[model samples]
Target: MIITKAKPIEEILPFLEGKERIFLVGCNVCAAKMKTGGEPEVLALFDYLTGLDYNVIGWAVPTAACSVRSYESLVEKNEKLKEADCVLVMACGSGTSVIASILDLPVTGTNDTLSLGGQIGSSAINHLCSLCGDCNIGDYSGICPNACCPKSQINGPCGGSKNGMCEVSKTSECVWYIIEKRMKTVQTLPILNKIKPPKDHFV
Candidate 1:
């Protein structure tokens, strides 16, 4: 599931302030279950706007607004959307782009699109290893130092490592600790003794 956060209603109102006809487009894909762009969220936003005395002409929720085929039906039903001042999309960035391509109306994002993962516990994502394109975990026994390291070092641990904890924060797990554990498990602890050159910051 793609994680997302809703934009504030105050942030969304300026676009439709003076417009007589406005449409609030919600997505049933990512934002629905996440409660960011579902029917309930849209209705709540519509009610807020009506309370503020803004003319909200109509609203609709389409299944997977990012899908080109799904948007075709939305376009059919909301032909009047063409006449709308703006189309406020509550989908991810990609979905907003898809909606803009099919509709001539100006598109605005109502959700802050986050990473393509689900929540694990405490509203935080688990195993958030942002694959930064260059991977060099083969020597480290498949453990990502880029993610585990507090400084995001790919070579060896910095001078600030203290008792298997990062110097930046005590909460962070040291990358070298994880690397050493992996090496020992694989019976390749001897590899840790080898000197690793400084990582190229550009790469």
Candidate 2:
């Protein structure tokens, strides 16, 4: 799932100014799971906009907002999508791009894309795999400190790791401790002790 956070209404309202007829598009996949761009969220935003005297033309919360073909099909079926002065996509940043690509209208994003999610728990999802396009999981004992750690230290933990929790985020577990514990259990502790050179990004 692609985790997302709702942009504050204050920021959204400013961008929406001077745009009378507005169309809303919400995602039913990742954004819906986060409760930021689902059907309920779209209707909630619709009601809010109606209260603010914004002429909302129409809205749609489809199953996949990132699919360009699906979006074009949706637009073909719903004339309101093309009739609106501006489109406010209630999904991730990529959903906005999908809408803009199909429609010639002024399209923009409502929710801010956060990260590729491993678990859907909080408004900000817990991330495990960053999809860095590099597979170094074996070296890190299947734990990615470089992705979860604020410091992004590939080698090991920094001085900030104390009491098995990260200094940056107290709720976050210390990644180095997790890696070492995992390595020891697998009898790969000796391999972990070996120093590694910098990652070759070209690879």
Q: Which candidate's lDDT is highest? A: 2
Angstrom error at residue 176, model 1:
7.0
Model 1: ten consecutive residues of lowest lDDT: 121-130
Q: What is the lDDT of residue 131 in candidate 1?
A: 50
Q: Cα lDDT of all candidates, in order?
A: 0.75, 0.82
Q: Deviation in angstroms for 157 in model 1?
A: 5.3
Q: lDDT tens digits, residues 20-93, model 2? A: 78999999988888888999999999999999899998999878788758545887767787678898998887
Q: Pairs clashing in candidate 2?
A: none
TM-score of each: 0.68, 0.87
Worst 10 residues of 2 by lDDT: 118-127
Clash number by candidate, in order: 0, 0
User: Which RMSD values do the candidates have, in order?
Assistant: 4.4, 2.5
